[model samples]
Target: MLLTQYLFQADKPLKTTIRNYTEADFNELIDIQKECFPPPFPSDLWWSEDQLGSHIRHFPQGAICAEINGEIAGSITTLIITYKGQDHTWEEITDNGSIVTHDPHGNALYVVDISVRPKYRKTGLGKLLMQSLYHLVVELKLESVLGGSRMPGYERVKDKLTPEHYVESILNGERKDPVVTFLMKAGRTPVKLLPDYLDDPESANYGLLMEWKNPFFEKTK
Candidate 1:
């Protein structure tokens, strides 16, 4: 296998900066999410400044955006939800059983969602955005990143309010959906792909659970 690496600065054609999600960033984030996803969660749900509050909102200042030519090219949200890793919502069966864990080191970054504007797809911006998160992940000594995938028609028909084309764009890949690609490049692995994982029981779907590990730890043993 061949590995490729290059020098990169944020001032290229597709430049991006990671910063706090603010009231100003909310509209752009919403637009990007809606553009890239189908059957998008109601804008009202996201309009709130609550950090998934009252719930285990890892709203740990991990949400960020990719600005290309001074515009919002993409946006990403990372939050960790501690679950019974022994079991999952997918069809896969496991015996791990009722295991509970918290941010062992106090700062694991979990990837909730990542999105790229339709026009900016494939310019390697997504990878850059993904790589930026590592600075925080490693700084916090976090364990891994986590998130879910939308089935082709799951979002569209889940609420029966989404347009068919919008759903297809995200599910099937509009301009190379990089969720799977970037995750792999960043040393993350997909542990599951289950059917009907989302709310739409009728929709054929799969969920991807990915992990990003620290290479330093691998060499010590």
Candidate 2:
């Protein structure tokens, strides 16, 4: 199944709240990673307690979560970075998911992961999470938000299309990829193609670099 495919229905309107993740949300986050990304996606890549600890320790505000009826249902992890204006793998920029390199004064908010419990997919919760991050960008006076997006739909078409053409097709509205399309809907624009960005076979080991610029940002002299 494609990532972000909504497969379950809730019995009632979800009472949701978005807030920065706390240390208490750690185990739920691990379960979320498993629900969002199952086997074939390496278990080792799941958010580790140490890495999650680093996020709260180094950049607490960048670690956001969504709660449904007081249950942690989704999360979006990020870090402040002095962007180099060049291509970098997820592992490189995210410091192998440890985010130990978080820069308190960096001008960019780099998203490391966005995981929604499988049941909450397509519930508008993802958009809420993204909007929270955008608000952070404005509040922090950051220039933009950046992240490498997984192209989970690539594997199906890789035999007949190059990654570039596949992505272009999605951008042109000729095709729709669940993950890429969701990110685009969340206001991110594709910037570059990152080869060997991860180990996911579904993405063909490729990631799309995406950005959302803050309109309120003022250039520092």
Candidate 3:
């Protein structure tokens, strides 16, 4: 993929800016996630007063958030393959082993979760979260960012990808997720699986894996 030859615009990011997460941002984060996701994560996800205390201690500068004109709109929890002084590259995350882990040595950023209240969906806040995660990865010096290209409570649905990537950003639907647009703006390419690696991902819609990084970040910024 010759991104440099394709069309460059690092001077303008996905039209969204980001900031750090804070207490005042918790309620909105909860509201948006709740509105977009179901079965909600542990109640602590929303009511925890330890909000910043939880992520900041774990990710330090990797936990990023955003606002739309002073209003809290979106947030993302990021883990570097290498964090602080330790590396988490050997760790694997699972939603009941439903999704497969392909790369343990890949340099990528995983977006643990992202949400923009239903009211805000299709309105660009989700794009903000994607952009913020992209920025966080650059600061951490990572090459790619990955997360489930998922629908909220996605296990009940089927994925579209046949095989998942080491780090995948995917979504379900008859169409590509708006996040795909932002991802393209950031420059992560999809993997072309070897015939042996081709198989249905255990999660929904095969898994719409997307990746982003580098010149995409530099040119967009």
Error of 1 at 126 (Å): 1.4
For candidate 3, give the lDDT of residue 17. Answer: 45
Candidates in order, TM-scores: namely 0.60, 0.92, 0.54
lDDT, residue 199, model 2: 74
Q: Which stretch of 10 consecutive residues in model 1 shows the poorest summed lDDT?
A: 91-100
Give the clashing pairs for model 1: none
Q: Which residue ranges in model 1 land beyond 4 Å of their true spot?
A: 1-12, 38-60, 89-107, 150-179, 194-196, 200-203, 217-221
The sequence of per-residue lDDT tens digits that candidate 1 reaches over residues 8-67 is: 445444334555455566667667767765465554434233432211233435656766
2 or 3, which is superior by lDDT? 2
lDDT of 2: 0.87
Can you give the lDDT of residue 90 in candidate 2?
86
Clashing pairs in 2: none
Ranking by TM-score: 2, 1, 3
lDDT of 2 by residue, 1-221 (tens): 00222222454566677888889999999999999879877899889999999999998888888888668889999999998777788888889988988998888999999988877886788877888888899988999999999998888899999999999999999989988999999999999998889877888999998999999998977
Query: How accurate locally is residue 158 in candidate 2, as Cα lDDT from 0 to 100?
Result: 94
Best model number under lDDT: 2
